[model samples]
Target: MHVPDGFINAPVSVAAGAVAATAVAVSLRGARRELDERTAPLAGLVAAFIFAVQMLNFPVAAGTSGHLLGGALAAILVGPYTGVLCVSVVLLMQGILFADGGLTALGVNITNMAVVTVVVAYAVFRGLLRLLPAGRRSVTVAAFAGALLSVPGAAVMFTLFYALGGTTDVPIGKVFTAMTGVHVLIGVGEAVITAATVGAVIAVRPDLVHGARGLAVPLKLRVDGRLVDAPAAPAAPVPAAARSTRPLWISGLVTALVLAGFVSYYASSSPDGLEKVAADQGIDAKAREHAAADSPLADYSVKDVSDARLSGGLAGIIGVGGTVVVGTGVFWAVRRRRADDLTAAATAAPSAH
Candidate 1:
């Protein structure tokens, strides 16, 4: 959920900002182990894809809608650390460029939507994988379950944050009940989107999917009437063309463009789960205007564009483009630093010897 300004007080908001900052710092370090040549670029595309899919809000209830939170999907496709960064990037872009989330409440939004969602979803996903059958289908199933729970997890976190710093004096129980109830319905949409996306990626390039890695069960051999683990097969040399991620990357980028640029026009126009809950519970009584409200691309529309379709389409395209560029730059930089560290260690080892 994109927590707007005035919903949380200055003290709690600042505290949440510190928490978000620490989480991002930790993720940057953890991502060094997660991002590599094959996965780094895909991580960027994942962020863009999440940004695009989030635009296509689906109806959850009569007047409430929901969209992909991307935590479970990203974590399953990439890794949890990188997934947090991906959602954070999308939130930042939306807040600054689209005026969708408030700048002042950026920390609160990041904590709830990025850190909490990623942590909770990935934990559930990994736990389920341990108990479920080892296969591509299991990955998809776990993704669905993780994504389903992540939405309500975020709702609970937001409720706690509001309970501490809410500007209005609304009943805490009411807020929690309404937030969790609606988000559970919203979670179904999240689960479907996550499972489908994870399944599709696993089908095409299971190698690229972090959560799908090591899914092949080792073969067993019976020797002298005793069963024992068979010798591992030597990895096959991949063809250069087959090793190229270009095809998948290009196809994914195209799909994101289609969804954001055109398909988003058909998405439900109703308020999302958080917005509906806030309005109903008087949580927005003190909500302040977004600082970027005056931006040309504010509210997901181009300034002075009369055609709703064209303006929204352009804004969506711009958002996807900007997110990809920024996200790729960030990920590539992280990858390069990791490579540099390895090279430095190798060089120092020779001198030590």
Candidate 2:
């Protein structure tokens, strides 16, 4: 929801910051297991894509709009730990660079948008995958269900946070109702986007999809009135250099640029679910101006750019470029660290023997 400054008191904001920090730390460790050679590069693409997609806000209720929170989409396409890092990176970039979210409220935004949504949605997705049929269709279905629930789950978390540290006086019940109600409608948009994206990836390269990793049906054969496991065939090995993600990466980057640089211009200008609820419930009364309000990229418009379309387009392009660079750097570092650790372990094991 991109909580702005002063929405939450200092004490609660700091506490949320601590919580966000802890979650990131844990996620970093968990991501070591999630990100390998094949998937590490996709992490940055996922973050940039989430950032671009989030700019395209769709109308939900009459005056309210919603965008992809991206927790479920990220988790389904990538792994949960990496998904947290992806959204966290996007939030960090938006706050510091574009002034979309407040600097002071970074922790609150991260906790609600990244931690809660990713945790809840991934859990729901995994549960559904277990119960449903093992196929690409089931993965798509789980992605939709997970994303549909994550939005309201985040709304509830925000309401709970407000109950503890809201800056204004508003009935908690009323706040909860409005937040949950609007977000539920918003969840539909999230579900559709998630399903479409997940389905597309499943069709092209299911191996790249983290959630779909183990979903492929195992080989079997019927012999002597009984079914038995088929003899496993050795897979043809491709060299690391030959397994280039350049094509997919270039395509994804181009798509992200198109969405942010042009499609976002047609997105609804209405206040999103969080903003609408805050204005209606008076939670936005104490909202402070963003620290980067005067920055060249503030409000998604380039400085001194007269043409609305061109200004917004330029800013969106810059944002996508910046997010991709920073996110790729972070994920690459993590991936290298993981690789180094494995190498060291393997070397040490020989000496131990």
Candidate 3:
């Protein structure tokens, strides 16, 4: 859930900001191991996808709806560190352009939604992968379970934050119960989406899936009444320039556009889990106005675009546009920085006279 301003006091927000900053720093370093030329471009696509899917809010309880938190999906498809960056970029775009999340509470939102979800989900995913059978099925199962757990993980994190800095006087126990219970239902939806998406990718290009990297376990063959694993074959080299990125990139971008531009218009207008709880528990009374409320792109409507379809279409286009620009910029910079370090190491080698 996107936390708006004023839900947490300034002191707590500052502390949350510090925590978020440290988390981002750690993720950046972790990403150096996660990212590569092939996967770097997918980072932006992942963010755009997350942004689009999040618009399709499905109804959960009577008046509450929930959308994709996207941490597990991103981590399973790409990597955990990059997953954090993906969702963070989406949140940034929404905060500045959609008036969705609060500017002052940006740190809190990033920490709760991006950092906590990605870290916890990936941790659980790795743990499960170790205990499960090593195969594509195992990867998919782990991804599903990770997605299911990540949503409640975020809810618990938010509950902990509220306990520290909630503006309302609601009972902490009640808040925990409501947040965790509703989020678990939301987590089911998250699991289905993550599994389906990860499975689809694994089918097409298992090589590209980071979580499925070591899935090529040799099949066992029985010969002369003895069982033996087949000898491993060396991978055929793929030319760097021949990498088929355009098709997946174009298809993903097209899907993201359609979802945000058209499908989102029909999404339920009911308040999401966080909003519902805030209202029910009297925590929303302190909700503050978004700083970008006056932006032309705010509220997912384009200024001077009268047709609902056209206005929303433009907003969605801008969102995808902004997300890609920001995400790619961030990832490319990180990638290049990594490259620069490698070059520096090569150059600093001892010279043989």
Best by TM-score: 1
Clashing pairs in 2: none
Query: Per-residue lDDT tens digits of candidate 3, residues 164-235?
Result: 999889899999999999999999988888899889888877877888887666778999999899877788
Q: What would the TM-score be for candidate 2 when compared with the true structure?
A: 0.96
Candidate 1 structure lDDT: 0.93
Off by over 4 Å in 1: 221-228
Residues 1-353, model 1: lDDT tens digits = 78889999999999999999999999999999999998999999999999999999999999989998898888888899999999999999999999988888999988998898899899999999999999998999999999999999999999999989999999999999999999999999999999999999888889999998899998989999998999998999989977889999999999999999999999999999999999998999999999988999998999999999999999999999999999999999999999999999999998996
**What would the per-residue lDDT of candidate 2 be over residues 1-353, giving only the tens digit for each residue?**
88999899999999999999999999998888889876777889999999999999999989999999999988888799999999999999899878998898989999999999999899999999889999999999999999999999999999998999999999999999999999999999999999999998788778788999887677889999999999888998977744777777788999999999999999999999999999988899999999999988998899999999999999989989988888888888889999999999999998996
Q: For every model shown, what is its TM-score relative to the native structure?
A: 0.97, 0.96, 0.95
> How do all the candidates rank in terms of TM-score, highest first?
1, 2, 3
Supply every candidate's count of residue pairs whose N, Cα or C atoms clash at under 3 angstroms: 0, 0, 0
Angstrom error of the Cα, residue 105, model 3: value is 1.0
Best by lDDT: 1
Among all windows of 10 consecutive residues in model 2, the one with the lowest summed lDDT is 238-247
